[model samples]
Target: MGSNYHINNVNGPAIFGDNGRMEINNGTDAATLLRLADQLVERMRVESPALVPQAQVIQGELAQDGRPADRGRIRAALETIGIGVAAGSGGLALAQEIGRVLGL
Candidate 1:
């Protein structure tokens, strides 16, 4: 089943086959996809505004002292999400985990 598919409590005759499979083609579900994308964007928008300045400051300080936190992991993760790939259930889980961590 595709990530966006919603199965409800509707008992109906079989449509596809005895065992069915669902595919999300070309991400045509614009409204739902946009909603999910917006959620991700919002998270970044909130987290990023503060982080970018801090990152730059820390990076500069570390360069001056010859010690830097390797931020490649964070940069790669951001790039991965920027290229239209849905983060899937893992993203949702991470978001929930963040909420729990912050006591939201």
Candidate 2:
């Protein structure tokens, strides 16, 4: 069966699904992405210094409140870091969650 989605206290659901695949639209704002990215940086700096630059790119974009995040840049950053961070600590899971929040 396809996974069930539940948003207990959300404003609305933004989901598109068929069969076993589901894609969630981003009801989450840049701020939320920023928070997740921030959390990663704190854990990543010492745990995996090599991935810091890419993580910073994600963090910096989400911190900008004046404009929307550059999805291309953010995706690239995510790709770069996800490769390195995937084998490290629990940070990869967090990064993937952030990507899901961004609807990437």
Candidate 3:
């Protein structure tokens, strides 16, 4: 899996994802997503700190998990961000692109 980041507009935080998708919209969900990412990283560190030392392997693992949890989070964040954006903004487009990447 590949990763990409985008901003819905000038006012928002940088949205992150693979294939330009995200699931963070309001401050609450955005915070949750950021928190989730942090938790996942922390969990990975505790469960397999060696991954930290192996960038390539870690990247691959993250990509693999994309199929289940990672991808779902990405989708949710994208929806949230899209809602935050103006109607007909790029958030949905980005989410759609991400879906394409996920082959959903």
Candidate 4:
């Protein structure tokens, strides 16, 4: 029941089991996932311009001060951009790396 984030080779972002398989879960902590989504957006802007717009949309939703009603939109956007977020401990190292890179 662990989760991990992954940037798929195609069809955009996705979430899967931590055991290196593609198994979807319910969801993860929005705050933390949104932060990672933000980082992914920035990275995509530099690495993959085509995904920037979608990523921006997700970022904007996450940035909203309310209850983040656009979680589904955010997930869809990430999926469209070949990114995924999972819930579990396996991604801690990658998350740390992202934080360091993004200076979060």
RMSD of each: 15.9, 6.0, 16.1, 13.0
Candidates ranked by lDDT, best first? 2, 4, 3, 1
All candidates' TM-scores?
Answer: 0.25, 0.70, 0.29, 0.45
* Model 3 weakest 10-residue run by lDDT: 51-60
Q: Considering every candidate listed, which one attains the maximal lDDT? A: 2
Candidate 4 whole-model C-alpha lDDT, 0 to 1: 0.53
lDDT of 1 by residue, 29-98 (tens): 3344334434544554455443334333322332433543233443434344333233454444433332
User: Quick one: how many clashes does candidate 2 have?
Assistant: 0
- Which 10 consecutive residues of model 2 have the lowest summed lDDT? 9-18
Cα misplacement distance, residue 81 of candidate 1 (Å): 3.9
Q: Is candidate 2 or candidate 3 better by lDDT?
A: 2
Better of 2 and 4 by lDDT: 2
Pairs of residues clashing in candidate 1 = none
The candidate maximizing TM-score is 2
List clashing residue pairs in candidate 4: 3-87, 12-81, 12-82, 12-83, 13-82, 13-83, 14-83, 14-84
**Ranking of models by TM-score:** 2, 4, 3, 1
Q: Encode model 4's per-residue lDDT on 1-104: one tens digit a residue.
A: 99656544323334332345454333445577577767767666666677678767766876778563464575466455554334332233333433333222
Q: Comparing candidate 1 with candidate 4, which one achieves the higher lDDT? A: 4
Predictions in order: lDDT: 0.37, 0.74, 0.43, 0.53
